[model samples]
Target: MASSIHSPNQQLAYQQARQHFHNQQNQKIQIFWSNQTQDIKQMNDFKNHSLPLARIKKIMKADEDVRMISAEAPIVFAKACEMFILELTLRSWIHTEENKHRTLQKNDIASAITRTDIFDFLVDIVPRDELKEDGLGIPRVAFQAGAGSSSDHLPYYYMLPHHPSPVGASGMFYTAPQPCPSLAYMHWPQLPQQEPPKTDT
Candidate 1:
């Protein structure tokens, strides 16, 4: 018996399917920067100690026109303010790199917030139209030609955006594609359980 060859249409379909698979794999890889631990630690310290306790309290007292603040209010506010600064800086840095700019600019911060939906509440405060006026709508620098090297410290991951929390309001986190190892085999009573059926002897 002779082995059969694929028909012309079948060959074409196979080639197209293979090409589609490669395209889908490529799409799954998104480029992003690796975290800088030194910068994170420095920012954490600044968040904790950069603001004076007295000043935070003083500002709270000044808002007595329509509000009252407890002693713990200043502490909370200071911490929140620090986190806000760090969040904005991180977001702006991402945009700067995305625009292929080495320097972080005010406009980059605006663009980041504008592009991200979580910052929609701040849209009224940031000038969205000014991006075009300032020529920032276009990436400041073009990607280097013939630079197929992945030496730019770029990394890729599969993740989904998490809801805003006090600590992770930035929503940047990695979620593993597979089931968690620790919980994969755990059984819970809340889940439906089946007991062995008994038949009359």
Candidate 2:
């Protein structure tokens, strides 16, 4: 109801203020962490996560191939998952704030993933709206750090000594996937083409 009364500029200003406050809070948290040397359990105790470790373990064990897991595996996986969730949420919140909205939406998640390079692995999962004139959406190409060329995104393959293929059999070659281009570096406008210097050939 309050949204109906606020002008677009007002909403933008509000969002900017909110984002500034959150950024300051994050900086404070980082400073506090930097001052402390803590164990993993102590860190976990300091931060709250919503997901249950048992559920994550159940999901991990659902695969028939995964017969056994170490006792510490679930705890490690749970913490990793919690951190992942926090990162995604913070990134999506940035998008929401940019849009001048307090509520987070699915589009915000897509925008966040599209803008973050590390999240490029999820490019195939996010759906993009089709533009009729273009026939397709933006190309799903990402730039991999330290990769010599940007030809194609590929997966890595492993050769297990215990499960070696026959000598005459063809070996699988895996390609590595590229990380998505960061939007922080994507804000340049195309420069106007200058006429080539008039030269007498």
What would the per-residue lDDT of candidate 1 be over residues 1-201, giving only the tens digit for each residue? 775686677767865765564455334322112223344444534335567878887756554353777766776677667766766777677657555799988777776666555566565566544323356576333224333334221222224456534345467553434434447568856967799999999
TM-score versus the correct structure, for each prediction: 0.40, 0.46
lDDT of 1: 0.56
lDDT of candidates 1 onward, in order: 0.56, 0.61
Off by over 4 Å in 2: 1-41, 44-49, 130-201
Best by TM-score: 2
Evaluate residue 86 in candidate 2 and report its C-alpha lDDT on the 0 to 100 scale. Answer: 69
**Residue 23 lDDT, candidate 2, scale 0-100:** 72
Worst 10 residues of 1 by lDDT: 149-158
For model 2, state the Cα shift of residue 28 in Å. 9.2
Best by lDDT: 2
lDDT per residue, candidate 2, 35-97, as tens digits? 433534357462344677778788787655599988678877876776677677777786676
Native-referenced Cα lDDT, model 2 = 0.61
RMSD values for the candidates in order, in angstroms, are 20.0, 19.4
